[model samples]
Target: MTDRAVAVRTAVFPRDTATVSRLAAAYHSQTESEKVERALTDGDAPLPERYAREIAEPATAFHGRRVVIASVGDDDCGMVVVAATPTGTDVSRLWTTPDARGHGVGAALVTAAIDDAAVPVRLSVWEWREPAIRLYRRLGFEPVASWDDREKMVCLERR
Candidate 1:
């Protein structure tokens, strides 16, 4: 189901590899930018080559992950990745384009992914991303623990 407010259309990737890959490249770029920022903050060097390779060829990273994409009409707005874990499904990635922010794109994508899960959903967000944390909280995800010094893990049980 598409979100009427944002007019977001959600789909499982690989089914439409060409469109999904293009959208995925955009998502990858956004994620890499965030990674670079985090690297700078942590005084670590950014792995440009690795990022490029991973984005150019996503099969390895997406092997076991279920990927979902959101689009507004013909324009891709965002994407999310969920993988089944021992305890539940792990939401490994969620990214929205700048133009898609404040329009429910992220929420739509996340909700669609979580709705398809057979178990609880877990996710980790960078501590500095207050907006994303707030979004997760609003969606009924509770803080479970600190994944690392930089990220906090949250979980949403099936309801």
Candidate 2:
């Protein structure tokens, strides 16, 4: 699907791993940056070491999952990881790069993640990520009972 300046599509493994890994690292960096800002995590380790497994093994890091990529022109700027569970499809790692914010990249990615999902689509986000929560809620996700054990995590579902 294409909207605004963004183009969305399922990521093809190996061929897309380079792009996926790059985005995943950026996502992880943003996460670490947030956690550092909130004092939830320390930046003692190197950036790559902090996300070594994920950056090094995009395919296996999120095993058995579908990855969606969003791009504007030549810049691949957003991604989400989708996986099926007994309950419903779960969405995670949804992110829009810093430079690509507010251009419908995130919405397009969420739409792609849910487009072919089974039954309801589920996702969890950190409570502090108000922008992400707002976007998810705007896209038909509603607050759901906590399904994750992480502190202050907000679970939402769209059925």
Candidate 3:
């Protein structure tokens, strides 16, 4: 499908559970091995349960966050979660299914998140995720800092 054919829209929590689950799984699978191992060693629940709680419980610190979903035709292809912080909006999660990688689903979701945000938006990506970094750059995000040796923070400000 063409980039123009994708539909991006705000997500409704429990109503979008299936879509969220799929995207969450995709995100989990792509996580750096070190982080995944750390989570496991810390006794965290399995990835699926952790993601479910993140989406379902306000106390999990996702209460007022904004979520966006991107779809092509009837298939949910990607999702993004933007949280309002004291400094700006932060994209906590952004994931696109493998099948949707080249169809602009990630870009569409990020655009929806930024358009709906109330402040400047920022996000962190693994330094090794070159494709995602390129996408963020294309959308006008510039590196603001290095979160660690492995992650770089990027931001997009209102013009």
**Location of the lowest summed lDDT over 10 successive residues in candidate 2:** 45-54
Give the Cα RMSD of candidate 3.
4.2
Residue 83 error for model 3, in Å?
1.1
TM-score of every candidate relative to the true structure: 0.72, 0.90, 0.75
lDDT of 3 at 66: 71
Query: What is the lDDT, from 0 to 100, of the residue 130 in candidate 1?
Result: 78
Clash tally, candidates in order: 0, 0, 0
Q: Alpha-carbon error at 76 in model 1, in Å? A: 0.9
Candidate 2 C-alpha lDDT tens digits along 1-159: 334578888888888989999999888888888878878767785665536777888877877888999999988998999999897799999988877888899999999999878968989999999999999999999998997986678999999
- Please give the TM-score that candidate 3 achieves against the real structure: 0.75
Task: Give candidate 1 misplaced runs (Cα > 4 Å).
Answer: 1-53, 149-159
Per-residue alpha-carbon lDDT of model 1 for 16-56, expressed as tens digits?
Answer: 45655666677656655665776633325444664454466
